[model samples]
Target: MRRIAPDHDQLLAIVAEVFREHGYEGASLALIGEATGLGKGSLYHFFPGGKEEMARAVIAHIDGWFEDNVFAPLRDGADPSAGIEQMLAVTDSYFRSGRRVCLIGAFALDDSRNLFAGQISNYFGRWITHLADALVRGRHRPAEAMELAEETVAAIQGALTLARAADDAGVFSRMLRRLRMRLGLPAKT
Candidate 1:
C-alpha cells in the first residue's frame, strides 16, 4: 500500500508519546504506527532506522525543547531568577504537572540505554552545564554552581520517579519548589 509523508514535528510528537508510554525495546512498531497514524512504510519514510531512529528524533526534539524553554530562559539576563521560575513552570507543564514521566529518564535504564546511553548522557550533561552557567550568573562560585546544577537535575529526575510511584504529582511539584527556594528564585505565579 502507498503511504503518506508525515510532518516532521507531528511524527516526532507521536514517536515521543509512544516512547514515553513504552520504553525503547518495548516500543512496538505497531504501537508507534497506531500513535502516528502512519503505516509501516510511512513510518520508515521518516525514520529509516525504525525505532532507534525514532528515538534519535525524540532526543533531537527534546534538545530543541530544552534550548527554547529551559536553557534559553535560564540564560536570559534581565531577571535570571524570573527566568528560572519560568523554566520551572515550563518544565512542570511539559510533564503535565508530574502526571507523566521524563522521556530522558525513561531511556536511562533497560535496553533503551544500550542503544542511546551516549545521547542520554549528552542530554543530561548539556542540562547540567547550562544550569551551572545560570547559577554562576546568579553569583554562585563555579564549583558550587556545578554541584548545585547536578543536584538540581538529579532531584528533578528523582521526583518524576517518586511521583509516579506514589501516584502523587505533588511530589514533583515540591521538588521544583525546593529547587527554586534553594536558588532563591521568586515564587512561580
Candidate 2:
C-alpha cells in the first residue's frame, strides 16, 4: 500500500484512543496500525522507538491538550466558580471526545516503572500545580488550595473511571457537581 504524510496530531489522537482502550500493556502495534490506518512499517517510521515512543508522543500531545483545554483558562484570573466550570467542561469534552481513559492514570497503573515515567510525573505535577495555583488565587489558603486541588483532581479521575465503566455521562456530571460543592465552589450563574 502506498504511504501518505502522517498527520502526527491525528495519529496521536487515534493513538490516544488506543491507549485509552487497551492501556499501556494491551495496546499492540497491530492495534495501533488499525487505529491509525498506518501499516506496521509506516507506524514504525513515525514512531521508531515502538510503543515507548508512541506513548511519549501521546504524553506530549496530552500535555499540550492540558495547556490549551485546562490550565490556560485558569491563568486568565477566572474566578473559583468559572474555574470549576472550565474544569467540568473540559471533563465533559474529554469523555465526549471518546478518549475517555486518562493517559496519566494509565501510566500510573502501568508496570513499566521507568518507561514513560518522568513524562507522566511531569504531567501530573504540572496539572496539580495548575489547580493549586488557581485555587490559591481564588482565596483559598496555600495549603488548603493544594489540598482542594488534589482532592478535586482525584475526584475527577475517579469519576472518569466510573463513567467509563458504566458508560454513563450523568454519573460523571453528578460526581463533578458533588465535588464542586465539597470544594466550596458555588454554581456559576
Candidate 3:
C-alpha cells in the first residue's frame, strides 16, 4: 500500500480541525503534524512561516467559507427573510449543531488573539454587518437591524460556548429557535 500526500486544501481542512479542537495556543506543531501525518519539514514546506502562518491560512479558509456560504447570501439573496433563514441553517450545520467549536471564537478568547486580531475582527465584523444588511432588507430600521445583528451573533457565540460547557447540544438548538422567533421567522417543524 502507498501513502498519498494531502493537497493544500486537504491539509488546511485537517489543520483547521486540530485548531478547532485544541485552539490556536494549544495546537502545537507536533499536534498538527500528528493530525496531518506530515513531518515538521513537510509542514514547514507548506507553511514556511510556521504555526502562525498555518493559523492565518486556516482563518482565511474559514473566512472564505463564510464569505461564500453565509455572508454573501445575507447580502445578495433575493428574499431577505429567506437569506436570514439560510444563514441560520448554514451556521447550525457549520458549527455541527454546537457539537463543534468555532475556531475563530476560540482564538478570540485565547492569547493568540493578539496575533490575529485583525483577521478575527474582520470575520466577526463582516458577519454582523452582513446580517444587519439582511435585516434592513427585511424591513428593520437601520439601528434596530444593527442591534439585532449584534444580538444574534452574540447569542450564537454564547450558545456555542454554553453548549460545549454543558455538554448539551440542545442548548444551541434552543437558542437557534429563540433567534428565529426574535427574527420573526417561522419555527422549524
Candidate 4:
C-alpha cells in the first residue's frame, strides 16, 4: 500500500493560525505540535531551522495572498472606485474569517528580540509601499496617497483590534466605509 503523506500546506495553515492567535513568543513548540499533530521531532524533520523558518514561511504565504488578491486587481487598470471596492471586498473577507492579527504584525511582535527583526521591518515597509503605490495609481497625489495609505492601513489594523476585542465586526466595517468615503468613493448604500 502506498503511504499517505501529511499535507505540509495544511500543517502550515494550522501553524499560521496558532501563531496569529498566540504571539510568536507565546506559540511554543508544544502548542504547535498539538495544533498540527506533529511531534517535536516531526516538526524539526519538516523545518530544520525551526521557528524562524516557520515564521518566514507564514510571512511569505500572506505576502503572496495579499499581492494576488489585493494588489493585482487594483493594478488591473480599474477606476478608483472599482479598485477601492475590490480592496474592501478582500478586507471584508479577511476580517470575516476572524484572522484579525496580521501575519506580519504577529511575526514582528514575536520576533522583536530576534535577528529576523530587520527582515520583518522591511516586510511591512514594503507592504505599505505597495499600498501607497496603489493609492497613487488610483489618482491620489503622491504625498496624499502615501499619507492616506498609511492611515487606511493603520485604521484597518486598529479596527481589527477593536472588532476582536468588542466581538463585533461593525468596528472594522465602519472604518472601511469611512475610508471609502474619504477617498471620494460613494459609500455603500
Candidate 5:
C-alpha cells in the first residue's frame, strides 16, 4: 500500500502540540513521528530543518490564530471587552483552564528560542499592540493604553503560572476579570 502524507496544517498541528506539551528541546523526532504516524524520513520530508523548522511552523500557526481570533476582532471595532472575553473563554478551553502550557511560553523555556526569536517577539508584540489599540478604543489615552496592554499580558502569563502551580483555574479566571476591568469594561450585572 502507498503511504499517504498528512497535509501541512494537520502535520504542523501535531508537531505544534508536541512542542507545546514538551518544549523544543524535549520534542524529539521520534515523539513527533509517533504523533503524526510518520516515520523519521517522512517527518523530515515535511520539515527539512527538523525541530527548528517545526517550531517555526508552530509559530506561524499561532500567528494566524491570533490574527483571526485576537487582532481581527479588535481591529473591526467589535466591543473590546466582549471580544476579549470571548477570546479568553476559548483560551480557557484550549489550555484546559490554564493547565496546559502556552506554546510561546514553552518555546521560551528552551535553548531553541534562539532559532525563532523574531517569530516569538512578533507574536507578543502584536498581542500588546492589538490589545493597546482596543484599550484606546475603550477611551484610555495612548500612553495608558500601551501600559495597560503590557500589564494585561503580564497578568495573563503570570496567572497561567499561578493557576498551574495551584492546580486550579480560578487564578486565571480572576485575572481575566481583572483584565476586563482594566479595559474599563462595565461590571457584569
Candidate 6:
C-alpha cells in the first residue's frame, strides 16, 4: 500500500498533539516520527531545524488558529455580547470541552517555556487584552473590564487544570456555565 503524506496543516496538527501529550521537552523526535510516520531523515527534511523548529511551527499554527477563531471574534465583532458568546463557544470547542490539553499552557509550565517565552506570553496577553476590550464595549467600566477579563482567563485556565486532574469533563462544563452567568448570558443547552 502506498502512503499519503500529510499536508502542512495536517502535519502541524499531528505535531501539536505530540507536544500536547508529551510536552516540548518530552516529545522526542522518535515519538514525533512514530506519530507522523516520518523517518528521521524525512522529519529533518520537513523541519530543517529539528525538534525545536517543529515545536515552533506547532505553536505558530495554534496561534494562527486562535487569532482567526477566538481573538478576531472577540476583537472585531460589532456586538460585544455576541463576541463574548462566540469566544466562549469557540474556546469550548477548541478545548474539546476539557478533553484536550492546552499545549501552550502546558509549555508555560515546563522548562521549555524559557525557550518560547515571547510566543507563549503573547498568546495569553492578546487573549486577555481582546477579552477586556470586548467587555468594555459591552458597557463595563474600563478597570472592571480589565479585571473581569483577567479573572475570566484565570478561571478558565484553572478549570481546565481541574477538569484534567479530576478526569471529569463536567468540571469544565460547570465552570463555563458560571462564566456565562457572570457575563449575563444564557446557559448553553
Task: Report the C-alpha lDDT of model 6 over 54-119, residue by residue, as the tens digit.
Answer: 988888899999999989999999998898998889889999998888888888999998888999
After TM-score superposition, the amount by which residue 178's alpha carbon in candidate 3 deviates from its true location, in angstroms, is: 0.3
Residue-level error in angstroms, candidate 6, position 51: 1.0
Q: Candidate 4, residues 17-122: lDDT per residue as tens digits? A: 8888787778899999888877888889988989878877777777777778776666563565576677778877976733376667555555443656766666
TM-score of each: 0.92, 0.87, 0.97, 0.85, 0.89, 0.96
Compared with the true structure, model 5 gives a TM-score of: 0.89
Residue pairs clashing, model 1? none
lDDT of each: 0.85, 0.79, 0.95, 0.74, 0.80, 0.90
User: Which regions of candidate 1 fall more than 4 Å away from where they truly are?
Assistant: 1-6
Per-residue lDDT over 41-157 for candidate 5, one digit per residue giving the tens place of the 0 to 100 score: 887788788778888888898789878877777767568766666656666676677777778866765787778888888888888898888778778899998998889887888
Q: Regarding lDDT, does 3 or 5 come out ahead?
A: 3
How far residue 167's Cα lies from its native spot in candidate 5, in Å, is 2.0
Please list the residue runs of candidate 3 whose C-alpha ends up more than 4 Å from where it truly belongs after superposition.
none
Top candidate, metric TM-score: 3
Rank the models by lDDT, top first: 3, 6, 1, 5, 2, 4
- lDDT at 86 for candidate 4? 79
The candidate 3 region of ten consecutive residues with least summed lDDT is 1-10
Instruction: Tell me the tens digit of each residue's lDDT in model 3 across 45-80.
Output: 999999999999999999999999999999999999
Give the Å error, residue 152, model 6.
1.0
> What's the ranking of the predictions by TM-score, best on top?
3, 6, 1, 5, 2, 4
Q: How close to the true structure is residue 18 of candidate 4, measured as C-alpha lDDT?
A: 86
| Candidate 2 backbone collisions, by pair | none
What total of clashing residue pairs does each candidate reach?
0, 0, 0, 0, 0, 0
| lDDT score at residue 124, model 6, on the 0-100 scale | 94
The residue-by-residue lDDT of candidate 2 on 19-107, one tens digit each, is 87888889999998988888888888899999889988888998898888787777664575576568667866876632377777878
Query: What clash pairs does model 3 have?
Result: none
- Model 1: per-residue Cα lDDT over 34-113, one tens digit each: 88788898888888998898898898899888888888787764666666677778889998888987888888866678
